[model samples]
Target: MNFSEVIKQSNQVCKVSPDGKYLATCVQYRLVVRDFNTLQIVHLYTCLDQVMHMEWSSDSLFILCAMYKRGLVQVWSLEQPDWHCKIDEGSIGLVSSRWSPDGRHILNTTEFHLRVTVWSLCTKSVSYIKYPKACQKGMDFTADGHYMALAERRECKDYISVFVCDDWHLLRHFESETQDLAGLEWSPNGCVLAVWDSCLEYKMLLYSLDGRLLSSYSAYEWSLGIKSVAWTPSSQFLAIGSYDEKVRILNHITWKKLTVFEHPAIISNSKAVLFKEMEKRAVVGSEDLSVHQLTVGNSLFSTQSKYEITQLPAKVSVVKPDPDHANPKIGISAMAFSADNRYLATKDDNMPQSVWVWDMQRLGLLAVLEQTAPIRCFVWDPRRPRLALCTGNSKVYLWSPAGCVSVNVPVEGSFQVQSLFWHCSGGSLILLSKEQLCLCYMDTEEKDQSTSSDCNFTI
Candidate 1:
């Protein structure tokens, strides 16, 4: 893999356009647009305030910049630069804003979850949705973007409202069985809606499009419950991560637990490949030259990383959380299914440095990646089952069926990759540090290249 030069960004990292043609980044109050392939400046626009959030329209013809603190949202058009629009929430105090599915409307949720205001750009009309509850994921849109599901609270009862995106009209409203509805997600096929309760209750209910409860599942009614959940792209399996450091997979047809995956500190499974990241710094002499690539010593601070396969019986580090703490550092806090639904990657907060990969076909452990530092983020390639992650360091780690490899960002040891995301095309990666970002171009010819002899390929 090769890396491009580092570029400056804001606290809000840049985003790749949904259509995969443009890149948008905000530097303070300025928004910069660039060609995704060439990385050249395409357009620049100044916002009214420092952008707290940035989003691209569904059609990729417009950009939305939101300044919640200012209670303002600005929309810029790519087709006509001069045609810009602004919406002010006035005294309602905006907390969150997002683009509607059609990209012709904007939805702004006022502070304290009072209501959701939908502003139509084409018709110049406004719609109001009240009683919006503030939860982990109170709103979700189906894959086709035709319908939206929102969790609502009214008179201490948990309710769900399904609305049609075309006219923002309420389609169905029904009370849910959840005590404290934490989040809701629509299935990829848009036929099922998964509503999960707060961590205090171990409850998950599947509802049909017409607000009918299809099935309900609860593992146990004790301690903490669900922390994260994800659905396979094929909509065949639903994986639920709980506070017990276990993942329960449910089949789409039966809506029953197909299997349970446990994250153990001691990894002794012979079939599971264990990879340990090793980092080293290269020494450099005083003499150096860089005009036309003459003899020059490498920077002493430049770090290189590689993955080494460890034998079985490896012990991963575990930090026990204090019981008196309000939010204990335990359970499977992060879980993601690969795009192809062949692999699932998960992280247990208590085991801060280890990542577990599970094989969906066999429903068993596949690999374990133990990084030296805590993992900040991990994402899957959009077009493949490849996985990439970062540890708040200057390197990006990748794992494919072939093997695992670690590549450093070529910024002379200045850029640390705190988080990263793969482009929509899965051709490159956007690595973000505290206030800077860069691009990593994966060599297409060796996109599935094998790692060193020390590494072990799982598939």
Candidate 2:
């Protein structure tokens, strides 16, 4: 319950520095840098117009930003804050911004256009490639950095365009017939790409990096659209979450549906799949307010196993599992979790809200935290079980088994925080709001100083 440092910005988009020393963000028409140790804003460089998106170069040397109103992209050196370069796209606005894995160049999209322009900072040159009439919403680079997976959003149908990164050449395109594309991600080894649709049931199409439709899987019994999809670190299994509040484990290579575990309620989104070390199994969360742990042998999907599916009810919201902890119930949401995983922190969409932690492990109830306004979002710090709750009242609360406690922090007024993410690497806790990203970290005096870290798994 002790977050003593603050990094504030005007814009909503912010990216942590690769090495975790500093944070680069966009503010009121400017780029700002803040020191993690001192919790002080050190440098600020104003720009001509509002920056749309920002990305840190792979080498951590430069931060490339796309200025929307200016219709230009610029790269700034972190070492020499004054040194910056700008490239023009000869358009009205900027759409997307990304850096190659090598950090040698960048890719930018023009407003409402199907063309993506590649900019080389070193050579000061730009290359353009056009695609079908669809705006690319999300994009990812391959592990080798040779190919790109672009998520193009059309009217009712969605498509993915595979292009060669080196020469900006179009390789192949895949179109969906049943559902709209919900999410796109490649496997950790860059071998397979998991594509989900937006129907009531979870449907996925796995394709190779070379644009080959390897295999497809569908759940006709479950009527939930694929909310979220996660691939294990080892790339051996793929976890799919559906509206039926069930998570199915599949074999990545064979595309076989192994087992499906049902949650208590309708899962509004796809559940994130992660490897839990304590149980040495897979942890899956659902919108019905439950998390399940299932053990699958290396060849279990190919054959059969005795480990029947077991699910424990969890808090339902736009919640994310605690990446640092492997415990089944230790998670972060816009709510809370009890000591024995029986009580969960939760709130509704109305005002005069009450925070309740329902105990699912013991199949019972725990405690309730009283609040004035509606509690919008929350998370229980895995390192600290006391729940951190943010409400529509514009306040953040830290509650424990003892009683109600408050953490010393500023009330973010720029925009309401929509989500909370505690970096497993241990630098700072990120608050994703509507307008700006508020980064909360520990002050230098508090004692435990853990470095923030991130895993590089695809999908």
Per-candidate TM-score against the hidden true structure = 0.95, 0.62
RMSD of each: 3.3, 15.1
lDDT (10s digit) by residue, model 2, range 71-107? 7777888779889888777744566667877787787
In model 2, which regions exceed 4 Å deviation? Answer: 5-7, 40-42, 132-138, 151-161, 164-182, 200-202, 221-224, 265-418, 431-459
Write down the lDDT that model 1 would get: 0.88
lDDT per residue (tens digit) for residues 1-101 in model 1: 66677778898448999999999999999999999888899999999999999999999999999999999999999889889999999998999999988
Candidate 1: residue pairs that collide? none
Relative to the true structure, how large is the alpha-carbon lDDT of every model?
0.88, 0.56
- Return the lDDT, model 2, position 327: 32
Candidate 2: deviation at residue 238, Å?
2.5
